[model samples]
Target: MIEAPAARAWPKSEAESLPGKLIIVEGIDGSGKSTQLDLLHKWLVSQGYLVVFTEWNSSPIVRSTTKRGKNRRLLTPMSFSLIHAADFASRVHTQILPALKAGAVVLADRYVYTAFARDAARGVSRSWLRDLYSFAVTPDIAFHFDVPLDEAIRRITLSRAEIKYYEAGMDMMLSEDIMESFQIFQGRILDEYHRLTDEFGLVPIDATQTLVKQQQQMREIVQPHLADIERVEGGDLAEVLRHSGLRGRYLQQPVWAEASE
Candidate 1:
């Protein structure tokens, strides 16, 4: 039996090459991304991986888009679409790419698919949205948390306990008229995810399981890649991880700490 070898710890930036992995967590609003991310982060750390967890739209550039969601006003489909696309672009350049290049596994709460689903649902052209995101860094792995609409709504409602502005009244858009729109849009996003996986060779996990269970699986998926990443990018990895620790060197994206306010 040819069993896979165990993972090893080594300094980065001493290697000739490294394959950094990008793990993206994706789902509609109210899905358990936050919980899964927390669990995944802990598990990855346990595995000796330098895991960095950040959420989409949490970057400074993307946080501004939340203004539209909170304004209780309907923006022109095109305007809202462009806003998120720009947000995604800034995040890719500022936050995601740097971490991936440095060799840390980036656990993103949401990603390109958010733009695919949200924009298209508002009657925007999917093709146009794709063009906007053409410049974003694609993930190495994208996990889609599948759940029934009602279940997702329930989960989101419960999650709103802290009352963040983005989470507030998001359920108001769940009327039956829009429910179909949500499903149709969500379906398209999933389809896009499948296509992306096929084209880019991404790993997708069924995340409907409990957070503990999901994260455990996440560990399995990511741990296997670490050894290779280290072997190739170990030297560079150490440097990037080191920079990530120092002030202003790692976080290319503006941390949306204000969003929690």
Candidate 2:
């Protein structure tokens, strides 16, 4: 049995004084977290909130390098963790923090917790991963979608044609069969996620429930955060920044002024 790492200190304290909310979702693949986040994003936008959405491993600066490594099957556990760290850092600087400072709600499909869980499962040191992502601010809300292992496997098998090499944790040599490897790998990740739920106070969602029910619960949990937040007029993010009164590099440009001219 793979030994679970002891819980470590959170990299950063809970974010306070930021006018906007950062909401993130985390779960194993097929746990339905992505679908739920998408639903929440749509609902928030419909309510006229200025929302910025980001996902894992999506930073353009490292996208090609990660892809090349993956294609070549060259990423070791450590290299994979570092590449993802760079990606998250780029997004935090270029995408997340600016939006938060602008008072725009930022919806992340995954967050630092992803690294804590996935990297730990990959045999990387939990302490090192925490330090690597120390620049991250605590989310206002982080929802972990929980599902049974068998159900998660069933969902993935039904949804995908085939699982990829890295996705199956094949590099770890857990099993000869791809499907078995995926099951074992995802199980480890799920275990780490459960550990994180307690350590980080992550709100748990029953992914086995109907989507509508789950989303209803999520919105209820989110409503209090929205009480003071104004919906963006015509869904313009710049409008949120202009009215936010927070000084930052985002406000130095006259893009809004140019548009009004």
Candidate 3:
């Protein structure tokens, strides 16, 4: 069995005392993180867990600034790295830390490791980026969905008309064509993620599997962590599924049942 990265001293002493568990799913674009996280959130809610969801770059403080910089293609690699770090810091204070203190399961779409990988790919010093995010608390469970480069690109391009400027690494000027640039840029990021898998002890999930299998793998890994959380009354998972436009009927069955059927 693959073990989590060797335990390191958590930066914030308060985080060590929190009763909640932090679970994170990370990968490049089109790796199915959001979909899997939504499923996990609903399943945990059905099991009477208090859950909070947070995503990368969702902090209000730096959203506009990052957007403007990306739109104008004005952000240097260092500036891009720092802006995302700022966004992460804001969320840690306002969103992550508080939820954990309240004993709520915190499901993050991406964490500081995302910065470590992407920033380093962009030529930032790995040690410097790690120090920049030294305040981040280690997640109880971190899964990296490993998808093939071609498959990820196919999924992303099929959904959108064209890849965004920054996502394609157009700023790096690696290729004259957008697709070529995206391939080169995302390939670098993917390689970095692979390196981080061993470095950080991220559980590798074969992302090319059917969604059902992926969710099953997620549940298996998450079940052990959920053992300590005391039950709590909260939102209805069925209603959440309905509101989110997921197939609501699945909530009637056990999570495993949904996968088997």
Candidate 4:
């Protein structure tokens, strides 16, 4: 494998080395995504890597737009998809690409695959959805946390008392039919993810394990990749976790408020 000198942040060159990789964890909203991210981030850091964790809809700008779209009563599937695409664009420019160039091992909770799967589920033209995310830079690893749709729906219900307006309005989206669609949706994106793996040779970590097992499996999966992880010589998962700043209990601060716009 030929590893070149690391790339610089776009439109500028400080000659900083950026050999670290991007790892993305993706699933439905209620999946234990943040927990796994926290575990992985801390573990990578414990291995002595410089790491950072961010998410789509992270910045205030994206969150504001997401909230507005979420509250609308009659959101067409396509309209909702546009919100996600815009959110992805903001995050790519402001977060993902910058950190990749800086050489930090950046972990993302959700990404363009979300746009692909969710929009395709919503009956959007898959070609157009692909085009919307065609600008996304590839990740070194993208892990899809697979789960039963019924279980996912149950988790979402336990967390939120009411569905978002669009979720509530679509009878098809609310039915087992939709759950079955997740099977098809998952297959399509997994195909895409597999193509990504064949092309970039990504790491895949199964997410069906219990919480403890998930953490352990993630560590095992990432160890070999640590070789490509500059400045991070070893992949002691615990050490990597410490580097990411999310080792202990996480408090979800109320980071979003109504936009005055």
Report lDDT per candidate: 0.56, 0.82, 0.79, 0.59
Candidate 3 local lDDT, 76-107, one digit each (tens): 99999999999999888777776666666889
- Model 3 CA deviation exceeding 4 Å by range: 1-14, 234-261
Cα RMSD for predicted model 2: 7.3
Question: Per-residue CA lDDT of candidate 1, range 215-241, in tens?
Answer: 666666655556665432223334446
Q: Per-residue alpha-carbon lDDT of model 4 for 1-261, expressed as tens digits?
A: 222222112223222344657778777656677788877776555555666667766666667667765665445777778877877787766666655665667788876766666666666887787667776776655666665555666776788766544443342354445444444444444455444434433444455678887766666665666686566454443344444443321112122222111
Task: Find the 10 residues in a row with the least total lDDT in model 1.
Answer: 252-261
Candidate 2 lDDT by residue in tens digits, 1-261: 111222233446436757778889999999999998877876777667777788999888899999999999999999999999999998888878877876778889999999999999999999888888887888888888999999999999999999999999999999999999999999999999999899888888899999888888888787778887767555465455657543333232212221100
Q: Measured by TM-score, how close is model 1 to the native structure?
A: 0.67
Q: How should the candidates be ordered by lDDT, best one leading? A: 2, 3, 4, 1
Candidate 2 collision pairs? none
Candidate 1, position 189, lDDT: 51
Error of 4 at 34 (Å): 2.3
Off by over 4 Å in 2: 1-14, 235-261
